[model samples]
Structures are given as structure tokens and as C-alpha cells.
Target chain A: MKKFLWYFSVTLLAIIFMFPFVWMLLTALKEPGTALVLSLPKKLTLYNFKKVLFEFGFSRFFLNSLIVALSSATVSTLFASLAAFAFAKKSFFMKEYLFWLFIASMMVPGLLYVIPQFLIVYKLGWINTYWGMIVPHLANVFGLFLITQFMRQVPDSLLESARIDGASEFKIWWRIMVPLAFPIVATVFLLNFQFHWSNFLWQLIVAQSEEMYTVPVGLAMFKSAHEEAYTLEMAASSVSIVPISLLFIFAQRYFIEGITQGAVKG
Target chain B: MKKGVRDNINAYSFILPFAFIYMVFLFLPFIYSIYLSFNQVTDFSDVFGGLSFVGLKNYLFLFRDKEFWWALVVTLYYALIIIPLNIVVSLLLAILLRKRYRLNSMYRTFFFLPFVLDAFVVGIVWTFIYAGRYGLLVNILKPLIGGIYETGFLGNAKTVMPSVALAMTLKGAGFGMILYIAALDGIPKEVYEAAELDGATGLKKLWYITLPLIQPVTTFMVIIGIIGALSAFAEFYAMTGGGPIVYKWGTPLGMTKVTGLYLFNHFSNLRLGLAAATSFVLLVLALGLSITYSKIQRKR
Candidate 1:
């Protein structure tokens, strides 16, 4: 009886939670209309998707987002791991001070970096370029900080053995620490990818060219430009939803682990 | 202790790539933003040599600016509601799902799906749901409210802030839910079992035991919630475009212009110095809130 009650409440809540996505799906399948009502399409079709994908060039935006998010996540996670290895395992001069300095940077709201970041990219004439999207955000203080905490848990005896066996410091980091800390690295990578993937404000500010737009920026622009074409806009948002939703479904463990670990340890 | 400067140098080499990039992109720009905030620049074309410094005028202007003050109050009113409501809702949901029930993972995923989504998507979809005329809320729930259909909250002067705040709260509650679930999982079964033996059950156990035990996670969530609330931009942009109808709303506040959106508008208008000052003010508030709450969180 208690189990039934539990299931009832949870399932009810879940329906409320999942309703928007379902509505989006339903909206995407229906024909464009003057008024959007919540109901199953009388005749379902892929016309909205076809229109959004082909005419509005959301496919290009998707690819742009993929390239930026994928490369940015990889590079930032690698950099963070490399620095994390140093902080976690090495006895470098001013290591504590430097690590704290990085952590302190995390407290600075990302908005603070926007103006100067834009200016620097503009100065270098990198605006509306891939470098403008990717390079400026590679210094992820949170990623470095999170991975450092994870790396500190790696047993020193293993590092000692690797060092004794004539492994160079770089080799040890490349071979040992990276492999052992791969879980946290993956977690950080996924987190970073999500940030870049859904990033809007910076891309909106810097990417004057439509060719450089990421998915969120494209979706936002699509919303305004096609305000009356609600079905087409729904299709654009639905396209944005699929990748992240799949990422959440498959890799939710790592994502939630990273967040909870932040609460407990970081 | 085995000590060679050589060993340290070798370790430092691993950190060099990150340090160089961090310095140029993040650290340098941060200092430059402070410099830019002191100047009035008409054009961002010559970022270096084109600006004449206006000293504290930007700061002073913002202090005297009614619209800026309105944004701050709306942000606070937005934050004050979102922080507490989200913390409660997510906590209640997490605690309710503490047991290893069937389909709990499915429930967890459904609840947390919003956190993973772009706020743009959430805002857009929810805007559709609250579309006043054709919205699900009106079509489905109108009878519940005696069929009184208006612009709903999205287009109202009095209710737009809370209306957007509600959507944001729902989207964010999932994040805190996941954190709370993790904290709940770490609490051993024996403690709860003992409480049960002592005749504490249901609400008694929750109030006396669960809340106190999960205090750290609660604190962490609260601090994060505050920062998230203050920095909210994309949602307001997507949903309200920063206003529906502007009024003083009884608190010297307009409806929905948040600090992030205000700063964003300034940036778009090429008011670079004022934008920088806004960023500075936002940054200081964020840091202050995080530090204050985290300090209190650690105290217990």
C-alpha cells in the first residue's frame, strides 16, 4: 500500500516534469498553426523538422556547436588534468598558492570575463572564428579544481614505483595519472561540453557571422526570426534537446557524481 | 624529504600549458575589465587607446540610475523566491524518493532532465505552455480557475517576475534533487533504523533526523542556488525579453529585468564602461553570497 502511494506521487511528478518535452515533441510533429494548442497532432508529419533542418540551416549550427564543444571539452579537460596532476602529486614551488589562486578565479562570475574576452578576441580579429569560440574558454578553473581533488586520491606508491622505473615526469602524468583519473576527467569533460554546447551569451556577443553560431544561439535567433512559425521553432528546440538528453540518459551518473562531489569534497 | 629543484621543475612543466593560457585569456582579461570599467568608450573598435577614463562616474551613475536599481531589486526578488522554493521542492522530492523504489531512477531522470537542457529551451517551451490564449495552462486548467483567461503572468505587470521565477525554479530544482539524493544515500541505514525503534517515524523522523543530517548538502545547495538565481539571464531573455509591462510593483522594482540581462543590454548598446561596472557589481555580490553562505555552512 505504501509502495503504491510512493509510485503514485513519483509518477505524477514525473509526468509534470516530462510534460514539456512531450509537448515539444508533439508540437514539432504538427503543422505550423496560428495558435499552438496542447494536443496530439491530427496528422503527424516530419515537415517541421525538414523545414528547420534544411531551410534554416540548423544542421550547420549543430555541427558548429559540436566542433566547438567537442574540441573545447577535450582541450580544457586535458589542460585541467595536466595541471591537476601537478597539484595533486607534485611538490612544486608555490603549488598551494597557485592552486588556491585558480580556485579563487572560480568565484569570479563568468560575466566578468565577457567584456575583456570579447575585446581580446576582437583585437586579434578572431571574432566569428572557431578560435574565438574555443580558445578563450580553455582555462576552466572548476574543471582543474575538480580533477585535482580526484587526482589527490591516487595512491602515491604507484607514482613512486613509476618514478623509480625511470618514467619521466611527463610520461608518468601521461601514462599513470591520466588513466587513473579518467573517471573524473570524463566527468569534467561532459560538464564542460554541456557548458559549451548550450553556451549562448558569449557566442551571441562575439559571433557576428551566422556561420559561427552554436545551437543555443541559433535556437534563440530562430525563436525571434520565426516567432509566428511556432512549429519550426519547436523543431529547432527539439533538435537541441536530443543530444543533451541522450547525454543525460547515458552519462547521468558521472554528471550527478561531479555535482554531488562538488558539494561534499570540492 | 628528497628535494631537488629539478624534480619541482619537472612537475611544473605539466602545469605550464594551463598557466600560460589561463594568464592570457582569463587573468589578463579580468584585470583589463577593471581598467575598462573606469573609462567611457563610444567604440569597441580600438579597445586599447580610444577610451577616456571617467573614474568613478560609471559606478556613481549606476548608483543613481533607477532602471539599474530596478533590475537589482527584481533580481533579488527573483532570487529570494527561487532559492528557498527550489531548495524545499528539490529536497522534498529527494527525500520522498530516498527509498529504493521501483522506477526511482526513471523518476530521477525525468525530474533532472530540465537541468541538462538549455535554459533557452526551457524558457521557450514554458512560454508556449503559458501562452495565455493557446497555452496548456489555459486550455487544460482553465476550468480549475473558473475559466478566467488573461495574459497569464508572462504579460502581466504584477506577476511576470514570479511567473518566470516559477518556471526557473522547476528547471533548477532537479539539480538540487540529485545532490540531495547523493547526500541521503551516504547516510547509513542504522541511524534511521534506530530512529524507527525509538518510535520516530514519518514526519518525525524527517524533521528530527533527516533535516539535521543533510544540513551540509542543504547549505551547499542554498549557496549554489543563490549564485544561479543572481546570474540568471538566458531564461529571462528567452521568456520575457526583460519586460512585459514595467511598473514600480510596490518595491521600487520593475517586473523582470535581471542584472545579467541588464548587463547584456548595456553590452549590446556598446555601453562598455557601464557594462563592466555592472559585471563588477554582479561579481562582488556573487562572491559575497557564496563566501558568506559557505562559511555558515561549514560552521555547523
Candidate 2:
């Protein structure tokens, strides 16, 4: 009986939480008129999906978001790990001060930097270019911080032994730290990818060319194009979510782990 | 001195990428924005040389602007309403799910689903749900619930901000829930077991033990929540176009507009200096709140 009630409440909460996604799915499948109303689809069809995917150049936007997200994720992770190794393993005069400054930057709201970042990009003549979108994000503070914490856990003796054998710090970082830090690397990649993919404001600002727009910008434009085309819009929304949802489902354990790692300590 | 300097050079080499990119892209831009904010320039084509000093007029004028104040109020109101509600709801959900049951992971994923979703997608999806005339509520729940059929929740001046707030709450609650769950997991089981032996159960144990122990995480979440609310632009842009009826909402748009959107608007309008000024103000506000929060957290 206790177990039964537990299951019942869990199910109810799950429904409350998952209702919007389900509603989106149902809306995507229903006819336009039916979607506007609260009724369930009498019969599901692929028409809305076909319209959004084939007719609307959503495929190009998806590819753009994917390319930008992946490029930024990969490059940022590498840069963060390299910097984190120095902070973790090296002893220098200004190490503490530099690390603190890096961490301080993380506390600032991202939007705070968006304007300056835009101006900088414009000055460099990198606006609407992939480099403008990807470069600023490549030196992520949170990623560096996460990796630094993780690196600090690895015993100094291992690195010392490699050093004694005439291996450079860079070699030790490349060979030993990178391999051992796989879990965190994956964690950082997934988290960063998710954030970059979902980021809209910067994309909307920098991506002036239609060909350069990410999925979110494209979807926003699509929605505005046909305010009354509710089913098609919902279908576009669903399509946009599918990739990120799948990515999250696969790596949720690590994603949640990475988030909590810092939350608890602070 | 030579050997020590060599080590410094090596260490700096490792950190070179961070310093170079962050300096060029972030720090330099930040400084430039401050410079831009103090200037007035009419033409974008002459950005570097054309700017003339404007003093505190931009800020003084900002204080007098009604739209700016409204945006500030609405932003704060959304933060005040949603942050506490989110913290409370997430804590309750975390505690409720503390006991082991089947499909707990599924429940966790369900809650987290909306957050991973694109904000534009959430905005679009909820727009339909909150539609005035032909929304799902009217067609399905209106007859039974009986009063929601007449109003467009997102279109109304009174309801637009709150309606958007609730959507943000729903999309955001899962993240808070995840953080709470992590804190809950870290609490030693024996602490709860001890509380149970003292005849304390349910909300009593939660009130006495759980709340105080999780205060750090709660504080962190609240700080982040306020910053998130203050900086909110994407959802407002996607859902409300920054206005239902143009009453201030306490968002960053009050002084600067969304730097991103402002830049887009003025990219062709030749008003780069004004846009840059707006950006600088937003950055300062964000940094000010973050510094205050950090100090408070440290003192605690």
C-alpha cells in the first residue's frame, strides 16, 4: 500500500512536469485547427513535421547550431583543460590571483558581457562569422574551474614521476591528465554543448545573415512568419528540441554530476 | 632569478591561451564598452574618432525613463515571485522524491526536460498554451474550470509578465530540483534517521534539519535566480517582444535594451554608441549584483 501511493504521486508529478513536452508532441501531430483547440489529435499524421522539415529550411539551421555548438564545445574543453592543468599543478607567484580572477569572471552574468563581446566582434570585423560566435566562448571560466578542481584531486606524485623521467609539463598534461580526466571532459562537453545550442540572444544579435543563423534564431523567425500557423510552429519547436533532448538523455548522469559538483561546495 | 623566471614563463605559457582569448575578446571589449558608454556618436561609420563625451546624461536620463523603471520593476517582480517559488517547489519535490521508488530517474528526467529545451521553443510552446482565444485551456479545460476562456494570458497587460514568469518557473524548476536533490543526497542518512527517532517526520524534520543544512545551496540558487531574472532577454524577446503594453518589467531592457537585440537593431541604424552605452550599463548591473552576492555568500 505504501509503495502504491509512492508510485502514484511520482506518476502525478511526472505528468505535471512532462505535460508541456507531450503537448508539443501532440500539437505537432494534430491538424492546425485541432492544435489551436485543447482537443487531442483524432489521428496523428506526419504532415506538420514534413512541412517544418522539408518546406522551411530548418535542416540548415539545425546543421548550423550543431556545427557551432560542437566546434565551440571541443575547442573550449581543450583550452579549459590546458589552463586548468597549470592552475592545478604549477606553482607560480601570481597563480592564486589569476585563478581567483578567472573564477570571478564566472560569477558575472553572461548577458553582462554580451554587449562588449558584440562590440569587440564588430571591431574585429568578425560579425556574422563563425569565429565571432565560437571564439569568445572558447575560454569558458566554469569549464576551467571544474577541470581545475578535478585535476587537484590527482596525486602530485604521478606528475612528479613523469617530470623526473624528463617529460615536460605539457607532455604530462597531454598524456596523463587528459586521459584520466575523461569523465569530466565528457561532462564539460555535454554541458557546454547544451548551453551553446540553446543560446538565442547572441545568435540573434550576431547572426545577421539568414545562412548564418542557428536553429533557435531560425525557429524564432519561423514562428513570427506565420503567427496563425500554430501546428507548424509547434512542429518546428519539437524538431528543435529533439536533438538536445536526445543528447541530455544520453549524458544526464554526467551533466547533473557536473552541476552538483560545484553547487554543493559553494 | 633566472631559474625562477623560467618557471614563471613556463607556467604562463600553459595559461597563455586563456589570457590571450579572454583579454582580446572579453576584457578589452569590457573596457571599450565603458568608453563607448561615455560618448555620443551619430554615425556608425566613424565609431572610433567621432564619439564626443556625454557625461552622466545617459544614466540620468535612464532614471527618468518610465519604460526603463517598469522593466526594472517587472524583472525584480519576476525574480521575487519565481525565485522563492522555485526554491520552495524544488525543495518539496526533492524531499518528496528522497524516498526510493521505481522510476525515480524517469521522474528526474521529466522535471529536467523543459530546461534542456530551447528557450525559444519553450516560448513558442507556451504561447499556444496561453493563447487567448483558441488555446488548449479554452477548448479542453475552460468548460470545466470555467473563467479562463475569455482572456489571452500572454496578451493582457496584467497577466503577461506573470504568465511569462510561470512559464519560466516551469522551465527552470527542474534545475533547482536537481541542485536540491544533490544537496539532499549529500546529507547523511543518519541525520534523518536520528530525526525520525525523535518522533519528527515529514515537514518537521524538513523544517528543523533539512532547511538549515541546505541553506548554502538555497542561497546559491537564489543568487543565480535573481541574476538570471535580471538578465532575462531571450524568453521576453521570443514571447512578449519585450512588451505586452510597455509597462516596466525590471529587465535589463530598462536602460540598455538587450545588448544583443540592441546591436541587431542598430547594426544598420548607425547608432552604435548608444547601443554600446546600453550594453555597458547592463554589464555593470550584472557585475554589481554578482559582486554583492559573492560578498554576502562569503560573509555567511
Best by lDDT: 1
What is the TM-score (0 to 1) of candidate 1? Answer: 0.95
Can you list each candidate's DockQ?
0.76, 0.66
How close is each model in CA RMSD to the real structure? Answer: 2.3, 3.3
Candidate achieving the largest TM-score: 1
State each candidate's clash count.
Answer: 0, 13
Instruction: Please give, for residues B178-279, the per-residue lDDT of candidate 1 as tens digits.
Output: 888888888899999999999997899889988889888777777776777677889989899877755464444447878888898898888889999989
* lDDT digits (tens) for residues B157-217 of candidate 2: 6667677778887888888888988888889989989989989978898789988898878
Q: Candidate 2, residues A142-202: lDDT per residue as tens digits?
A: 8888888899899999988998999987899999999898788788888889889988878
Instruction: For candidate 2, report its TM-score.
Output: 0.91
- Candidate with maximal DockQ: 1
